[model samples]
Target: MIRGVRGAITVENNIEAEILSATESLFKEMIKANKIKAVDVASVFLSVTDDINAAFPAKVIRMQEDWTYVPVMCMKEIAVPQALEKCIRIMMHWNTELRQDEIQHTYLEKAIQLRPDLTKQ
Candidate 1:
């Protein structure tokens, strides 16, 4: 089955280093929480707030040791009024046998407020 694991993190600035660091951290957490392997990932879709334009979050995934072949796409998130800023959201399509409810989602840094419920898990 194909399952989508969600994760999000907030970066301190639009600098490329900061964006890449935060994205790498978030990606690691998501992989650890869901016990995901790069080979099992079908694809990844990453979206960032309009304020973040220094770098593409997908670059972090490609840097992983065995993730070079994992399909990844990055785009700007919708500019919602009063929504969180400097946030990077990820939706990873994974091939797994786990049920929907068994999947784990990660929300970190200031992005924790986006899904308070899942953060507690």
Candidate 2:
């Protein structure tokens, strides 16, 4: 059976390093929680809030992972009133045998507040 894992992280700053770090952490957490190998990921889609336009999160992931095979895309999220800023969200379509409840979703920093029920202890 295949499962999808969703994760998100917020960068406190718009700098390239900050964006990369937050994204890297989010990916690590997602992979760890879902027990997914890079090859198990069918595709990964990332969306950044309108405030983040300096760099593509997918490009950063490819560079950091040095994986030429996994597909990744980045897009801009709709800017709503009082929406969270500097946020990067990821939805990973994974080909795995894991059950639905076994799939772990990660929400970090400000993004955690967006889904307290999922992120809170």
Candidate 3:
């Protein structure tokens, strides 16, 4: 069965540089945790917090890596009060035989505190 994995990062600033750095780290950890390869991923959906209107994190992610043809989408995260700031989140649907418990989700930086249990799991 296929599985969906999620990951997130918190940017230090709204600037493109900070966003790129955080996103890069986030993607690395996410792919590592989930044992993902280009062939395993079906699609990735990325969303940035309202404060991060500078650049699309997903585009930066693709540019940083030579992903040639993987499908990635970007959007703005809902602006909820007291929500995480300058955050970039991703949901990747992958074709895998792993069970739900075997799927790994990464939440790094400030996002690490979002779900401590999952981070440890």
| The candidate that achieves the highest lDDT relative to the unseen native structure | 1
Question: Which candidate ranks first by TM-score, i.e. highest?
Answer: 1
Ranking by lDDT: 1, 2, 3
Query: 1-121 in candidate 2: lDDT tens per residue?
Result: 5677889999978888788888988998887776678877788899999889777788766875545688889888888989988999999999987777767789998898887877746
- Which tens-of-lDDT digit does each residue in 19-66 have in candidate 3? 888888888888887778877778889998878877778876577454
TM-score of 1: 0.97
Error of 2 at 62 (Å): 0.9
Instruction: Show the lowest summed lDDT stretch of 10 residues, model 3.
Output: 59-68
Model 2: lDDT equals 0.84
Question: What TM-score would each prediction reach against the true structure?
Answer: 0.97, 0.91, 0.91
Off by over 4 Å in 3: 64-66
Clash pairs for candidate 2: none
Candidate 3 residue 83 C-alpha distance from true site, Å = 1.1
Clashes of 3: 0
Supply every candidate's count of residue pairs whose N, Cα or C atoms clash at under 3 angstroms: 0, 0, 0
> Model-by-model lDDT, in order?
0.94, 0.84, 0.83
